[model samples]
Target: MPTIIMTKWPVKLDGSVRSKAMAFLQKLSHDDTTPGLHVEPIGGSADDRVRTGRVDQFWRAVMFRLDGNNERHYVIHGVWPHDDAITVARSVSLTVNPINGLPQIEAASPSVASAGATAPAPSALSSESAPAAISPAGSEPAAPSTPAQPAPPSEASPAPAPSEPLLVRLGRTRTELTDRLGLSADIADHALSAPNQDAITELAARHEGWIGMALIGLAVGESIESIVESLELDQPHPSSGSQEADLLEALRRPAARAQFSFIEDQEELRQVIDHGDFGAWRVFLHPMQRRYVEKSYSGPFRLSGGAGTGKTVVLVHRARALARRNPQARIVLTTFTTNLAGALRDGLAQLDARVPQVTGLGDEGIYVAGVDALASAVIRAAGADVGDAVRAVLGEDRSQPNGRTTSAGWREVLDGASTSLPPEIAHESFLAAEYALVVLPNRVTSEAGYRRVRRPGRGLALDRAKRDAVWSLIAAYRAQNRVEGTLDFAEAAAVAAAWLETAGSLADHVLVDEGQDLSPAHWQLLRAVVGDGPDDLFIAEDSHQRIYGPRTVLSRYGIKVVGRSQRLTLNYRTTAQNLRYAMSILEGADYVDLEEQPESTGYRSARSGPAPTIVPADSLSAELDEVAKQVGNWVSAGTEPSSIAVLAGDRFHCERLARGLAERGVAAAHVEREQPPKDRVAVMTMHRAKGTEFAKVVLADTGATSAERDRLESLDGSARADTELRRRSLTYVAATRARDELAVIQREGRRA
Candidate 1:
């Protein structure tokens, strides 16, 4: 049976007592018959501050373990007052046995034992220090009392042998250590499992001052064990065929798997860095970086801003992010026009190279295409029947006028709808059917009712109930023709939606740029394509530049405008004075508010710098000469000749302006219902300037009066509407063309 030991020592003793204790331990270790002793300091000064105050003062207690033949030693740990008298008394109670070489448990004094046997225990003693005693059997007498002297070297014991396994120590405090490192357990585990011994040593060294490192070393050992278990090996000496088979199996389980996993983790870390997680440490990033990350994770989002507000910049970032998130999937990027599409691709390429540190995005990553391109691709992919249907429809409508079709045309087509309708009527009916298919609620209906249903804003204006009935008939017609591969743009969207609804799947996400320019028909198509999935959808647009037309269906299409829905209001392209003058001309009474003008160096208008000159020319030739002289002054000032445009109020005026300017060596080309000019001064109608800008705009026919004015004013409903459209068109053109200067020359006799 193992024997037990107990000891007590004064905490306030001088350096002599410490020397005595050390000597006793040293003697015991050197003694042949004694086993090793382990001395562990239980709780020491917690920090440098505590250590300073307690350095001179002795500790109140010490616990030590000893081993001997058929005997074992265990220290009974205790806490007591720092008083010298009490500590001395407690130390006197300590005893040691020569035979077992262990400290015997201290016993109660005779007075206390007799008092306890005769009467109830005193409450004061019980509350202060509970009297503890040990069995008298096999116990040794106390050391003889003597004048205090330095402890003898013969009393000390040898140092204890190392016993605890490293792995066990690590397992005990894994959570505590990992928490301090600000790391997840999985990551910590991976780090600890580093294959190289040097790496393991360095990791262990990082925790040198920590008590937890003792356990961490063991964890490292466990990681090594796991790694070893994962490795596969074959028999040392196998037959020729067996050896060949083993070699083949080894090749199938190449070591690259571990290497690849590590590389992937490293790449994810790089992603975090590019996402501006490390921006706080850096000075700057390309403008697209912030826009990209914000729009990518901003959930289903919408953006609205003025022109030059970086809406397109944000769109490029979103496309890059989407491509990164779905590398293997085809990403479709669509814009309203071919020019815009080309510009977007160029912008994306520049962004990739400029911000190459951003992960998962490359030059070839995004597939930038236009809406027409996407539709054509989808139609072709649907099969030969769909292709033939599209071609036949296009061929039949060869003579159809360009631009948005009129409501009157829609009425006639709906009135004469049959299987053998004209190609133009068929095209109109197809769009109408598609709109009904997507926007109408699902239901059944009769043929008579279907014919009565007219498209929105068409037919004789009717009361609420009659209009509702028309809508119902439209819905019924749509329900009857819900066939796949039979939809035009609107119907295609509805069909895609139907596939999602019935077939139960959708693309990972959808992204739309320049969303504000999308028409009601285009929006219907987008809704059908997106369906009801959690796939991320990012939409960006500038409402002020909705130059496509004035119909908005964004809200009805399920995209929610969020955040401020505006960019920083400051304009970077134009001087504050120029912006103020431009806004004054363009804004009028509809202006809600204007951004405060920023201080700026005055803008230098191109040579012949005159505030817009409004000359009333007596003849077209006279006006052409004045315009040519102004153009000549700009050209002499180093402005490119192509930077100038001569805008007229009507197509006929544009033709005459072109011919007159040509006579003056201006080389003006009319931008009417014709292909764009290659290298000549643009003589465009004011309406055609809706999405264009020019450095110097000459309003040739601004002096319109009488019948010409009446004819021009009759095209739109209200005078205010026509004025606002023309003003916005001018603003768009002027703002875009003039990076540095703007000139607007009005033909004086062309009445406003």
Candidate 2:
């Protein structure tokens, strides 16, 4: 029996040494004529050099010994650089039959003149003339005439293999397993030794069919079987289906289902105000509502509805749905005003616990902000140079004349010339216009811009005033940027859209709240962000509640209306009588009954509140007193302090009402166009009260014969505005602030 010892390579060898070693082995193997003739490397050019004390350096070597008698055992050493003949030098000698005390020795043959000449063929060597056996210590052993016998074969089987291991076949021309796996050869070797066979199998299965042929040479039988199994040529893992089920189960938790339910409720006429998981309930939407939740798609989607419908609710729901569907995508939620933005944020938060994560349209993912805020964000992201220019031209303290002139200059440069302006120039011009409009008062810029110049004293010159207004706008922009370090919601959305277009595609869906309130600019910006995709655009709005300003035209934007408009007509918050009263005031002859169902505990109107009083006040102060008295009574009757809102037709009336209520020891807070501070009773103008609801409401100045009513009806050009504003106000005032009671207070001198 021969013993074979395996050791690591001692030193890295160059290409020449490796080639020579291979050639020598081939020569030795060709000369041997036995089935199991072992050919191994001995210390030579290919051998690893190792330190052998102070005497010399030894080479790590391999020795082969053959048992069959007819086979020739050749010990070849040394690898030549080229075809140079190796000088057979006596460097190390071997000893044979040491135990038998037989002395044997061999000497290296001198270099032959024909160095590159091929050695004599194996057929030239006779069995009896084979080389004598030499021992490790350089002794030649005496040869015996008898032949050696063969050993019995072994009976051990290979180890059990992995269940689904990857199999790779090496290419004929290449020794690498990479040709087998279709991977780069370098990766193939390490990949085969990957710690997790299942992961490798899964990875391979991703490439499936072609892998079988590609990996043909590298796999043993067991590994091949595993690969076959992975290809689904065999049964799949028994646990696969269960694992899928587990994933679904994780997604269906209460938190996940909340948004879906909220959306369903909104669609079903439940009229549930901003309740439930706003984020999760949106996820439960049917295909139509879900469409709006998409981040990107064709738009011009119009969400038109009457007052008290869940338009804003749907918008928040859509946003939630979008966030849920695309956890990684960014979503921007913006409204026209800071107040609306805050309401949206609060409403969305109330809808889902995760809404907090989705709120605040920061520069980061999925955010809620106002228009100005969004614009600011856009300016900042465009880079400091553009941002500074915008700030300079739009700064409020810069004076009106200069700002307007600057704005006109930039607008003229950008408007029709946008195609020609470089990105930097376009950005600067946009900033100028944006700042101009943002900072200028409504009187100067008009709520929406077409073109306008200011008169000196009366206003600044058209171009000069525009420039000055632009400067004023820039001031506000700077303040927002420096103070809060955030863009207003509108600015944020525009910036976010720009960011998405540049950074990557927008989210899979986008949900806009208060869709009716979105401006043309906002819609345009959102359209740009969504781009062209299969994604959906969902907008929820009540046209009747267009109290803040003009609503964006959905039809003009190319959004096709699908199915009939979804109407949430049921009035869940008010009593049938209250709904009737409110509707009559709003719709007059056109009002239709809402048919509210009775509550199980039996309906009660604000714990025995008064039957709306008609007072005869001599003056505004007298009217204020009457209104204050009514509010005090509601509080005494056990209504929550925050439940009551003083509804007025105008800001002046709201101020008077707030003062009167305050003087009566009622701690009330005015609901401005922006967010209100916490802990105060609300005194909101009719226009600002659209989506909000309260426990009890006092609709003051409702007397038909009052001067206010006459003024409301008398203005020919303002008729539509008054009607819309009044109807919205009546609906908002009656629907909200009436969880239990609604009070209509009109001076006695005024006729019905």
Candidate 3:
């Protein structure tokens, strides 16, 4: 029996059409090659081979053939009205580009080309090739359309002269091209140096989805580097085995599968045929993501990618795999914030609802919670009373006069120290960094230890006198916290790490998502929880999306990832235009990996959307009005209010905007890294917006107050530059959270 590949069309059908389609699919699943099934041929270009089967008198299912290793595979492209399905079957043409090995599509009929007729509405298959119409068996296809000639480059607009051949011009060998383009070596080499150019061209047409587009772009004078940067290829691994088998397997890739649906077993196929839709995430692993999930590491392993690259997805899957493989294993899924941990728990639940060991802050199986929450839990298990310490800083109960919230106390310290700072130091920022990077992680309790400790990544230098003053400032703050019986996050994390070393391990494996936001103390605690052995740690991180926490290398904290690291370059979320806008904000800046390696490049998105809008207003009030109007527009366009977010630079504006929008009848809620309520627009500070996403985002304020800018400027040397970069990165994070649309609204009037 032949294998059957189902496209995404069944879900698009309804009423009579859907019922008929299901009946036809059931019959095909029973016997795909049965003569009575009536898989009639539709003549077209060889690369666009197709066939049709009747769903009913008015509708037909169009499909293509892929020769698999064990048997032939029939891929159902779509079920359409008889005429539309047949027209698509006969007119479609497919091809792959030689350079990138991605697919492209075009109409094969001369009349359609001459008439400039648009293709039918998009289906999963239409995303790959043109729709074709049925032609009688043995009837010849219509004459191929003539290719359009390019207009000559004018005096003002010039194109580069074709020279040195495309392959020679790229100056990369097969291996370099394969690695850079994220293609298999065979596909990259074949596209560049295939013995028969026509054979390569023919292959391009049959696999025109992502694979064909790359080859076609190369054929049309596009540069390999540019092509590599423009398209998102979820799995760029090279193809192997026979050409037919390789091409067939490529079509089954997670990226291509994302467009169409595919089912392997007959029972599942029947259920899908009967129900018309199967959950999309069950088998949906982009090639890169599959590798990340399935590969085994001998020790600590990390996966990094840009926002929406599915790092968290990999962690969820990996957690499930570990849980299922070892019944005795205890696993923990963690992230920097509670909201992200909640999202992770929800994701893991979807993957395996019966995993038996799912709990928050538990000791065994799979536990999902924030890192700090886990640390506090571990501390409590060790017989420590952590409520007062944790509550003084994080608790929302502000009714008591003696409450010493971390934020309020930190601000007070900054204000008191600012008046007495030496010229070389930015007192507030410098003291905070010293505490986090020096005192907390290193467990430096005395002045001598603080003076001897090395400060890496801190750009500013401090003399002995300055260091003494910083230590005194830190001591003063610690004394205040001690008096209040309150512990800051770092102090708590430090204590948690030490307690874990003595209290014994908490789990067999620890999987961290949003790993980039974790501080050094957090990593130390995570390291102490699991044995240093196989599968001990699996983390997904992206420094480009680091919106909070100090930057620290994992290796420095004993979590080494020297040879066990992967970088995902393709972004599966956010359209190309929105991604480009986000990239432009971080352009020219440098970042490092977990081990301090230079950042990798070639980040690209496979999808496209409208360019981000920047709305300028005469004043702050006008900016708020524009933001509110934009939110209303998105709602009018049918987006859920919960899918929209409005972010600002500080809490005051974030809260004010949420209130302003609520007054305008837009159900808006101010959420700060807490579980966002459904059906209401979320408004939060940029810091709180980290590790979260929305369909549409409105950045309420972009203009920095003159006083704020002046204060930053007063900082000495690169410290000022670092602050600005962090601000820009925060904006970038907010902008990229928008999967479809982004609008930046800011005031423009001069300061008094």
| TM-score of each prediction | 0.45, 0.44, 0.71
Where in model 3 is the C-alpha error above 4 Å?
Answer: 1-76, 81-119, 122-282, 360-364, 384-405, 412-426, 628-643, 659-682, 714-719, 749-752
Error of 3 at 224 (Å): 6.8
Poorest lDDT segment (10 consecutive residues) of candidate 2: 133-142
Q: lDDT per residue, candidate 2, 623-655, as tens digits? A: 777677767776665555555677776687788
The superposed Cα distance between candidate 3 and the true structure at residue 95, in angstroms, equals 13
Poorest 10 consecutive residues of model 1 by lDDT?
A: 133-142
Off by over 4 Å in 1: 1-289, 292-295, 324-326, 353-365, 384-461, 464-510, 531-535, 562-564, 588-619, 645-656, 668-735, 748-752
Candidate 2, 436: how far from true, in Å?
A: 14
RMSD from true fold, candidate 1: 32.5
RMSD of each: 32.5, 34.1, 9.8
Question: Candidate 3 at residue 108, lDDT?
Answer: 62
Q: What local distance difference test score does each model get?
A: 0.38, 0.40, 0.64
lDDT of 2 at 6: 13
Model 2 misplaced regions, further than 4 Å? 1-304, 355-364, 384-508, 558-564, 588-618, 671-680, 703-737, 748-752
Mind sharing the TM-score for model 2? 0.44
